[model samples]
Target chain A: MTSPTVFAAVGEVGKDFFKERTTDTLPCQSTDKLFCWDWARENFDRYETPLRQHVELVLISVAIGFAIAFALALLSHRHRWLRPPFLLGTGVLYTIPSIAFFFLLLPLTGRGRDTAIIALSAYTLQIIYRNTIIGLDNVSKSAVEAARGIGMTDRQILWKVEIPLARPEIFAGLQIATVSTVAIATLATFARGGGLGEPIFGGELGIDFKTNIIIAGGLAVLLAAAFGLLLLWLQRLVTPWRRVETE
Target chain B: MSGLLSQLPFASIDGAIEFIFEPQYSNVTGGNKVGGIDKVVELTINQLQVTVISLAIALAVALPFALYLGHKHKFETLAIAFGNAGRGIPELALIAFMAAAIGVGLLNVAIALAVLGIPPILTNTFVGIHQVDRAAVDAARGMGMTEFEILRKVEIPLAIPTLMGGIRGATIAIVATATIAPLAGYETLGDFIINENVYGENGVLAGAILVALLALALELALAGIQRLLTSPGLKPRPA
Candidate 1:
């Protein structure tokens, strides 16, 4: 059969399947009622609660991960023996499959948000740690020497000089980690507290195509715009000097 | 350091090896023992296959687009915006959408991964090519090279390190993300981990170690590739 004919046949098959499955005990009335914007408006709290929790999970994990990564980066910079293994290990952690990581944690921690947080936090380590190291590495040797010559203590040099200079790279890492954290949190839906993944999975289980498409597509657009704006704001905050330098 | 290391919980390499290779420890779904070495090996290979295929697709699509966007000022802003959007959307959501639209299986997973993998590659490609020394490009053009020739012979070689860096990042991301493939019912190492969790077994720790090992192996391999690609004569030195 031609492609259009094939699609039509598939659509009919899907319709028939839905019809067969439809029963008096079906949850949430008919699928048609669920599609209405008014229905979503009325049940906004149900959706919003999960969305907020997912966001909270992502933010907290990222905050904690960034703190750990920053400390590791500092320690790695000072101790030559620690650098290689630390970099290599974090790189590996960053690369491990999120699902595998979550599952691995799940046995110990069980299902739900905590496991998801730990998994996502582990994933963020490489980006934040590597970027922190790279940012410090990229700091001009002369700057460090100058600080030392001026009698700045090691801690003072790091907090006052190196970190300020490394802010841009750190922000870049934050941008990456934040975006990644948001994306991965959608998988938290698997543990049952529904996020954007709910509709997509619902669609897979033969729920309404339009509903799933709307939820997934709308969420994608919202996330992309929001994060992009966030990066812009962060850039402005961290590197106000950028504007002056360019000007 | 020795005291600290000893104090912390440490699983020996030998223990890991034994757990991975002994048949008695192998627990497949349906309460069957599939044997350890074979199960772990199969799962590793499965993940490797998915990562490589997805990375290949990402590189192929991202490179040319990056080149095109780099050269054309009119399209630059739009290209960057597109990449930013791609970077923002979570891979899990993208995978779910793809699975919903195309139905589940390997191809859907690959396509979803490729989508997730594209932005980094594209952004890096554009940045790499744009950062190619102007003098080199001018000299190439002065030598009567066509636009295509300059890009192929002059710009790309210089940009390879940055491009490779992006590919390295993309490869790592895809390999890590591909672990989620089991969620959609495709059998991968993630299946072993997820299933072990469902059954309340010791396999979870084994699965974690396996994933860690695989990720370490992938990072080493990619670093090796990056080193080879960025050798002295092949690309410009890092500025």
Candidate 2:
């Protein structure tokens, strides 16, 4: 409508592209260097709370997910008709994206760690449940038959024979769930849950700061790897027969 | 709990539904009408565009390589490792890093999304083809089929379910990541979710609903395609 209006429109459009996030007082940050070691050294302490939050989010989510999924798997294994419905329910939960899931629960759960953990745990349900069921199904029929011949009860057979044999697949599911939770928990920031995503999404220096992105992103990757390795080690410890078989 | 729920912001299910169907006046937009079916449809199309392009690129790149590896029975560890590593790369970080470093647009966002798609496809394809019955391949070979023909007519057919599983996983990941494409300046369905200042809370809820539906629909469509492509004989018969 006017010259001032046109200029203002142009400035609004170009601001994200043209504006410098940092002042020239800091040479590395102002120059838009790929990674500023000096800036990182100074600002690295800010990532501590976010990193801790990220770890807690992943751990709590995966733990709750594994519990629910494992219980469901056992229940469905006994009641054959429940299997399909359980699978469908968890599949729907899994289908919803983490970001959307966060918001969909916003009204009910409110924005916080509780909302994030619920969504993240829900996402894990399908994967872990499916794997656990598959693991149970894949147990050798002969072992069950032998246990029956020995006059073992159905519960006893399931606990002793089927579950023991299903260890590898069950542990595999746990590993996958843990790793995925580690990655997705970074989005917990959207729910005001606070995680590594806070730093990447411009906690202090803003998203334009490559150094911040590198530190936050790298920590997430490292966290995933750490959880993955920890799960693998735990798996080996719990499944002594697996070690023997591999050896 | 009900009392707590009533006190929360943006908890209006009815309001979100109305926001999806009709533009509403927004104080954030200075009383300008924002969101509605038209804006939702436009953004949904943009989201689907990025998702489809990224998936196509991922399939084109990962399929051949995975198939070759499966056929040769080589580099099993490498294929499997990629699957593990890929799962660990946080989607939020990947997109933010891409936007910050490589600059953002449809292409950049698509590429970032594709990076998420490739590993699942590669791992599933390799495992699927590798696990195909050796007898089936030998029979195809005995019928004077070339290696390529055997792969096309026998191996791929047998591996359809597993291959489709991978594609479904990739589709889910790509579609989910595409919801964040607005951060990269691509104006996907995430625009409503991200620019809450203009679109308001109702639009945010609507965006979430639409994204969830879109993902489920894509998954269902892929599952249908997988079933259609599979040979009739391979279909499980009821006792």
Candidate 3:
């Protein structure tokens, strides 16, 4: 009842915007209840770890996906016949459901970030690989001839001429990979790698936690949109010639 | 032989086949209660129901709307926005989100799958109809055909292959997604893996392979349909 006790109570009350997750003890295991925040509270800045980890997972997956896809596409481009089978193999990989894909990798890698990355990269491979192949094929033949006439070696022609011309398509593929990976990495929760979906499947909060679900789901959508816009900006930066061609 | 195969660290090819074929006769019921061939067939059918019903719903709604949009030459910006937004949400995320709103059940899972199916079909159909030769449409118009008739007679035929591209894409994607239907309280091939207590390690491995095989089979079937649907003259020359 003294001044010191009053001050401590006020500070604790104000600390978490709402009470910490343990505030509510819902005994109702019944699914009939409306989605209520009685059991849930979002401390606004509590999402920092999930946000950082989600972004990291997405960037790493897309980076690895683009590199692997580029190599495969390049190999196929050189051999010509390898393109069909390469496309077929990756297409089959894409057709595997993301959850099932995770389980398939679970035994090999066990759990956590690496397993999530491998599965997500598998999903990204087909899109980037196909786009890379298209980008290379679309490089103007005359441009390749022009590069050769300038005494460029085969590797130099690819590095200097074809890849530069193909930048937009390759970047476009990266954009797709980035956005989708951000979205998919949310489910990295299932792989024991926590992300936005931690609250989404409701976990400790239970499925009926309204505020938590909104915060998590809304963040996931926002993450995807922000990442997508960043890619679009990067694409514009990397492909200034595209603007010239279009306008 | 099956016992030996199961003891292997990971699932072997022989294990998957034997699990599928032998479980019906043998005493090898997984903890998931997936007894044998009858159960496998049942789960397969359940998976198909989710896939087929959801796909049908998505196609029914998206196709007509896309064709109409193409006919009117409207909603191009909206279509592009929808496509981008749709691609940004993973199938698992969509399914879980729907489960929250509707509660978990077979119908809820099917609705989730349907939402997954819509964007590709809508995007592809819109692009397809838009890509039809303008001169042909102008000629058909000049011949006094109504807008609807022009769309049907001129645009729809030419646009079939591209429209089917959307269908093929959606079908394959939905079939894959349907594998998770069991996790949301609907029984499907995923039960083999999702109910870890029931199927244990062998179920998980065999289920993964079965789902993959089912998807590949669907892809092959859809590709064949895509070929059949493509106009013979539109088929590219052998390279």
Candidate 4:
């Protein structure tokens, strides 16, 4: 994916960029110096790399998780026994601690962004799967019967009737998973994958309290705004009928 | 299931208990021993303490905000947006932020978890209260009940199921996520798992399994609580 490429390129360049531009170029000794537009401009080259990396991590992980969830939802619908086991397994996976899950995978997978993506994707499975099932189930039984009465095949019924009906719920689930993926992707910093978390974690380790606070708070606001907007856009796109229905 | 349990290192409940309490005596068939049993027990208790305390604080603080939001049309949009934003931020980042600001410890962990925990509780409380039969609320008001009395007598009871459901969901999420607390140097069951992983020990699997079992047990207990809380009054009325 372009996400992984962007992430890798960013990480490779970030440290060098930070060292060159930020090492001895301080206008003030106070932590507030870091927040100045001049300081930002000087450090912008350094910051761009990690920002790209963070975005890529969120995007790639959400994409992978969404694909897996879609496939699982489809298969579970196809087979009865599979549904229960899949639900049970994903439920347990969802409950597993993300940090622990990442650490567990780290030894086997070795440290990097991929481990974080895999762990977050596993966590996404439960919410997405449950919502998908509910969405599919909510497709009116009468509609299915009518489709069959009209001699439509099962696939046709699914494509034309079931999917459209289920899209809202499914999209709601996706919105949730997307936001969660973005948030959790920040933790990928622990494995040296560089994100906004890099600044947060770096500040923590360096005992630079001000930097840590600023980065963490700034990231939170940014994530909230970005995800909030994305969710609104998604709701508008996938559930336009909702507006119509309410009207 | 019993056979599967038997194959596990600490199969029996008593055996698990003993293993947790007295790690020195516990046989180490695996290469990894992250810490003694007492450490695991202490960590588990610590995590539980953090989770419960934070949840209580969240509910306490959020309930009134929820009630206020439920009553005020102007605040509803703001409340919903705040809740959504709250849910959107990653728990880890919040924890990291808290740890960074306050220094790493239990309080920081609790604050972070509480922040993450509030939106669900608040939103659910507002939703549950709002979903109450409007007529019932009106009747209470007509009967000369004060606003507070109406809220207490009519709205809260109707909202209990949904409020409990939100609490249940939040509890599960918190318990599972609390393992992250260890990263900030606060001990939890995650300590064993993370430590085992770092040192190349087979114990990571066992630690993971134990944490998973702990989560399952908590979930089952909460489900039972939900059922009890929501069941008795849920029967249909006669036509």
- Best by the TM-score measure: 2
Q: What is the TM-score of chain B in candidate 3?
A: 0.87
Assess candidate 2 and give its lDDT: 0.86
What local lDDT score does residue A43 receive in model 3, on the 0 to 100 scale? 63
Q: Across residues B156-231, which tens digit of lDDT does each residue of candidate 2 receive?
A: 8999999999999999999998988877778888888877778777777878889999999998998899989989
True interface contacts retained by model 1: 0.37
True contacts kept of each: 0.37, 0.63, 0.29, 0.26
> Residue by residue across B1-239, what tens digits does model 1's lDDT show?
33333233432334334557874434334655543788788878888888888888998898888997775533666666666566566666565445544456666577688887898899878988888888998999999999999988888888888887788778767877777677655667666555653422445556666776677688788778887766478755788
Comparing to the true complex, what docking class would candidate 3 get?
A: acceptable
Give candidate 2 regions above 4 Å deviation: A1-27, B1-9
For every prediction, compared with the true complex, DockQ reads 0.31, 0.42, 0.27, 0.23
Lowest lDDT 10-residue stretch of candidate 3 chain B: B24-33
Worst 10 residues of 4 chain A by lDDT: A1-10
Candidate 1 residue runs with Cα over 4 Å from true position: A1-39, A76-82, A106-112, A137-157, A189-224, B1-45, B71-81, B195-200, B203-208, B234-239
Best by lDDT: 2
lDDT of 1: 0.69
lDDT of 1 at A61: 83
Models, CA RMSD each = 6.0, 5.4, 8.2, 8.8
Worst 10 residues of 1 chain B by lDDT: B4-13
Interface RMSD of 3: 12.0
Which candidate, 1 or 4, has the higher TM-score? 1
What lDDT does each candidate get?
A: 0.69, 0.86, 0.75, 0.67
The number of clashing residue pairs in model 1 is 1
Q: Rank the candidates by TM-score, best first.
A: 2, 3, 1, 4
